[model samples]
Target: MNGGGSCSLGSVLCVITGASRGLGKSLAWELCSRVMPGSTLLLVARTEKALQVLAEELTLKYPGITATWVAADLGTGDGVRRTVQAAHEMNGQDTAQRVIIVNNAGSLGDINKYFVDFTDPQEVDKYFSFNVSSALCLTSSLLKVFQGRPGLQRLVVNVTSLAALQPFKSWTLYCAGKAAREMMFRVLAEEEKDLRVLSYSPGPLDNDMQEEVRTHTKDPDIRQQFLIMKESGKLIDCHVSARKMLDVIQADTYNSGDHVDFYD
Candidate 1:
């Protein structure tokens, strides 16, 4: 309002991991419209180029919206620290009325292998490091930075899947990771009464991960089902799912620890 430029000092602080593409990317766009002028979005991903491009796009398209990108592997402790530090130092933090942390960074794991084939301890631990541990540590650290402010609304969303509830033939790692991550947030919701926690299962999305399932899934039946979904054009669009999630947040009626699926 002072300089006459399009940008404004945003007050909403949103941090999204795995934000380079898919649902995370769509969330960035969807959230931009919902927040008032001067809202900030911190995008986290391992690809620097993708993050940079996204940040520029968000900033350019949405007036008064500030989009920042952090390219780092959230699997490591150092990466978690760097991201938390960046969030703590982000400008206009004092003005923020709301904080959103979306723990969406995850992997399908080695889908080509069956359960018995996954024998190595290091391999299992590595899979869990990124898909499971990263979300836990990163969310806890950011909470410490943004906590203790009265009237400051804090929301944490864990991107989960049906695999958490049901077993898939060759997706042991992915299933276990989703289940563990969902449970973690459920526990958080119980421990932190002020925080709103959501375990959202976006369903089978029409994205790169679905493509991987169609091609690399070791279970013949599961692969065939995914292939059918692709062939029949049944996979859910990322934007559509993102919108549903945004609607859920705005509605704010569900129990904090409940698992809400796209169909639900």
Candidate 2:
């Protein structure tokens, strides 16, 4: 530990969203393998069963790391509170000197019929709430806990997308949500000097979300774009993406508010 703490990495605490599957799940395993022995993981997701299974697997595989989880619907205020409370409980009065928050959970909501769903209020709300609002709420809540430590290093990784940067017709809502999330972190980075925020694009992956996006699009061009990637085997593996992400974030010169692509 850098701050005269007994635990190396200063009693690291990682709070990860969407921990049950996809990049989130891979990140949990990747972090456990990389971080110090005394690190603690707080996994968040909507499904309890999946989280429980992951917790057991991580605890068994990486006995040095402690794992806990809170299953909550991330699109709601209650979900944010529950996640914060779970992190506090896991902290157990002795907080970690180093905290990492990975905001990985997001939604693509009605990508196929972007125009048809344009009038749907609930769809729009869900897209923003889950993709942008949830991350903001969680980060704000945890900042209070991580601040004022003797040698605190607080880092936030906002899982971003190409949709955020490139304008894709059928993915209007998806693009907007990701873009908003990235900008939020960019602003946060400017305000919080001690907090390091990185908007990371993991590149395309062969995940459930990809499958959904491929099938939902009525637009031939949009559908074919995804189809070509799948057929061409261009999608990155979840575990490989996870490993590279950890490496990139741990780089000595990695700065706050960096818009990093996996290839970079």
RMSD of each: 4.5, 3.7
TM-score of each: 0.95, 0.93
Off by over 4 Å in 2: 1-11, 93-97
Clashes of each: 3, 0
Candidate 2, TM-score vs. the true structure?
A: 0.93
Give a tens-digit lDDT track for model 1, residues 1-264: 012122221257899999999999998887886777768889999999999998998888886878988888998888888899888877445677778899988999999999999989999998999999999999999998878589788999999999999999999999999999999999999999999999999988999989899999999999999999889998999988987887787777889988999998
Residue 110 of model 2 has an lDDT of 78
After superposition, the stretches of candidate 1 with alpha carbons farther than 4 Å from their true spots are: 1-11
Name the best candidate (by TM-score).
1
**Worst 10-residue stretch by lDDT in candidate 1?**
1-10
Measured with C-alpha atoms, the lDDT of residue 166 in candidate 1 is 98
Candidate 2 accuracy as lDDT: 0.84
The digit string of per-residue lDDT tens for model 2 on 1-264 reads 012122323457899999999999998987787666778999999999999999999999878789999999989999999998998787763456678899998878777675655887887887788788888988999877556566767888899998889988788888888899999999999998878888989999999999997898767898899899999999899988887777776663567898888888
